[model samples]
Target: MLKHSDIWRAIDRLAHRHGLSASGLAKRGGLDPTTFNKSKRMTPDGKLRWPSTESIAKVLEATGSSFTDFVAMTGEEGDGTGGGAGMSAAAMRRVPVIGYAQAGNDGYFDDAGYPAGNGWDELEFPHVADDHAYALEVSGDSMEPVYRDGDIIIVSPAASVRRGDRVVVRTRDGEVMAKQLARQTANRLELVSLNRSHPDRSLPMADVAWIARIMWASQ
Candidate 1:
């Protein structure tokens, strides 16, 4: 059962996960810094003032947080670390993990890009509301500087894709790559290479099999 306290606590957890204060999270969402301040949670008469849905929407969008993540942040309150924020143990799960090289193989993912075949490694990770979330191990210099070899990135196919977000894309020919999304048109997608040594790509939508947003990464 949801309660008023749960909602406020969720907001705090969200801010904590992002290594921000209530005021900082508000600023990041383009709201007044005091929007989530403790004082704002109550009226001058001492009545409870719930957070607006619009505010929640903006913060989620700004943080690139899936609704599932926000929902997971609700329910409990415990001491969370500052700056190096992490989810509670109960919110962690073992997700399918695959190497970047193996990710392009046909037997690994379904047509929609969800993990399918066996032989995948498992990694304990933060709660991603989408059950289809998986991890990919990096292995090359193409995504250097930002994502070096040996790093792991979590991908969420259920999350919304937008310009400026990092993403993993699989082409019809079975080529898989990660890049920052720069632009998207009715027929084309423009991706910015993580490494300057690698040229950016502009691909027709017809060539794309599937694309998923990078929700979390172990840097």
Candidate 2:
């Protein structure tokens, strides 16, 4: 059976493969731009809203994908969670997400900064090779101007961090902050705050618990 979420995930994967948003895919298919949007995937009363066959046909034509191709993407198995359902090799990924404040707490992450316990809400996003990639939902305006409150920022612990790149850094004192790397050395790290209203941070490397590069953020 094709689960509703699986079909939507397939549509999202299809759009991603073609470098388009779901709305962009719909517009290319001659449908309303919001046809495949996440909001349209469910009704206001929280009812499932499956995509119409005609819309699927139009999208297939727009992207030059066969019905078989679409079905393959759908996986026809389950939600892309357990048993690797709705998988297209690595086109769909489910990552853990928790609030920024919660992430600062212990037990959520291991010493290496990888997701540790099951205290996260899973969210499906575009293909990401890093299995340790997770997202932190911003809680306050401290990271404003660049990442506002409620923004979900994708962080990759496996991704390399460099100077001038935005990163999520945790301190030995259990403080979590998102800032740009001004400098990093064997003994110290210099960070520039995203919001100029906040002061820049310079910390000894020993005081740094772990740091992961911010890969993407929901706008």
Candidate 3:
């Protein structure tokens, strides 16, 4: 009988074949860059967490592989080449992808375009506006208890980041991070870190790359 670990191992092999780590494979698939990160493969309690079919399909597409190839990769003998019951390779392929550091930023990304970087991991996500997808990496413990270092944040580029919404933004100097938007107006943006250890920060609109509202995190 097939096991969850078996499927995980197959995905690991697929990543290795592409000269990438498991996390890298997820990036290639347009999922959250941390989707395949070892830290995320298990729960905080230390139990294994299986990759969703949506994530698998996304990985296949990002790597330019087919459903049949994925099935072969899974090593599930006699299981038809079509995707399993959870997700279809075709549907997962169509979702947008983004890099971790690039999440939450706005102007820097375009719906019809891709972020500039090779470091990313894949994730399964619902279909959204072409312009509304991206990812970001946790830089500090500012969002602690909720988001930690190395956590990947998925943001919807098209979604409006309102006050209290966790958003990603980059300064003109390229300091990118995820913070809750406390206030926004024509002139400035005020942000509060989820972690009380870090003080709130504010910046002018001109200093930002682009801001996107965060939708989910791999925590």
Candidate 4:
């Protein structure tokens, strides 16, 4: 039996293989840009919203992928011998992890928010599904209750972030912070601290280096 997750995984893999985001793939296929977005994968009532055959066919044609390739990506090819064993393993990737202290240090990360130089530790985080995924280890109690010391958070620069999403933001002045997104606009961003001890902050968007959504956290 084909699972809804299986189909979506195939789409995600297809997009990644082509170096395109789900929306980008959709756009390339002449479909609405949000057709394959994560938010559209499920209905408002929490039911799975399976992609239509027409959309799938269009995307396959756009990317020059065949239906057979899509099936193999779903991990349903072969003689059903390996089953889903390889799927889980293939989904995971070694993510570079750095302590919050080291994150603020120079040369630890590049301009695009990717780990650049050395001193990074590796952690086997379960499928972030984003090429720009990285981990940050919390070191202080500034974000306690929600995120305590030693907690590892997986961030995805490729993920779409909205209000209420936990985010990691770095400023051009060298300030890096993890906070809940309160608001965002053309000129500024407002962030709220999980810990009441720290006051909410508002910064000019121009001063922000990069802002990535916190995808997952290891408590």
Candidate 5:
């Protein structure tokens, strides 16, 4: 069962883990800065205030944290490092990440390098330049242990996506996927999954939408 104190404690730890203040975390989650403030944690009558489920969900999305992790944050951690102003502004200017499964879909990313629409589920990360940036979420168990479902991956568009690099690719018909780049012959690219349970696949160069080297993951 969820309790008010547990929720507040989790919020505090989350801010610390991300090196953000309560207000900074709230801003990254697309909420009003006061949403996670100490004063907001109580009512005018002095009753303990609980964070709303929607707010919690947004915070989780923004921080790339799971429900289990949030629960584990109940124990107090030390005060997080400061520089909230700089980091918050830097975060706002950085490239955004989205679920990996959505990359190849035509409407998900635009030619201008901006993620299409405001519909993306986002994660807060240290600033990354726009040209070398992209975000993808892990899907399925094919890359398990190394990458898990729901892990947000950061891709460097400026980095050369060569053979042997882990990459995010799109199929001609609009399927997005992540796998290790294998062979790159004249007309095709081969990809392999980390999990041996899945067979390797070869795809024609013409069938790909975009290819970029994966830089890091939140997992």
Candidate 6:
């Protein structure tokens, strides 16, 4: 039988595995920063406060984790690889990785934004269910604080992007940049840089070749 503590321990382990504190994990999951705080884990009267299923689901989605991974972290009978044991094999996919500098090069990607020929490296990660999923390696300090040098970001062309979503935008001029979507109109787009030192950018939508939403990052 699994105890409540076992579940809590699994959550803590999951957070640590992602190099995040409880509050950091909560924020990444789109929850209130205090959602996983120690105070929230117990009532003032000392009664245990269980995590909500919705919150767990959100965290799993944010972390690209399957139910099997969660169970493995619970010290279950299976190997603790967090490999999504109970999930389908298709859940694991090889994504092409490219440096930020190469991303702006022409002929590297097809018209649909899929990687084309050679000169590409690959990484295996949990599939985000997008065939156009790819990875971009951060190379400079332009996107620091949010994304450091050497961090790999997973981008999904098929993923729906909205205001506030981090996105990789390629322009017709061969400029590729990662920025937060500040505003989007049918004719124009406004982007906010991650680094405070950089100024916001605005571009005509017609100047963009493609824009993909960033799903996750391997910090």
How high is the CA lDDT of each candidate model? 0.80, 0.80, 0.64, 0.79, 0.69, 0.78
Model 5, TM vs. native: 0.60
Q: Per-residue lDDT tens digits of candidate 1, residues 56-162?
A: 99999977887777776665544333323455577877677677888988888898889997655456666678899988877678998997655678899989999
In angstroms, the error of model 2 at 122 is: 1.1
At residue 167, candidate 1 shows an lDDT of: 99
For each predicted model, how many residue pairs clash, with residues at least 3 apart or on different chains?
0, 0, 19, 0, 3, 0
Clashing pairs in 6: none
How many steric clashes does model 5 contain?
3
Mark the regions of model 5 whose C-alpha exceeds 4 Å error after superposition: 1-93, 111-114
Question: Lowest-lDDT window of 10 residues in candidate 2?
Answer: 78-87
Which lDDT tens digits does candidate 3 get at residues 1-219? Answer: 757777886786566445454665665676776787757779999998988989988888876777666556666432233335434444432233444445445544444334544344544443445443655545545678887555556666667567789877766666777788999989999998778787788899888666767777754
Compared with the true structure, model 2 gives a TM-score of 0.63
lDDT (tens digit, per residue) of candidate 5 on 65-121: 888778776644422333333355445433454655556566777653346775443
- Tell me, by TM-score, which candidate is best: 2
The list of candidate 6 runs beyond 4 A from truth reads 1-88
Q: What is the lDDT of residue 18 in candidate 1?
A: 59
The C-alpha stretches of model 2 lying farther than 4 A from their native spots are: 1-89
Models, CA RMSD each: 15.7, 8.6, 11.4, 16.2, 8.9, 13.5
Distance (Å) between predicted and true CA of 104, model 2? Answer: 0.8
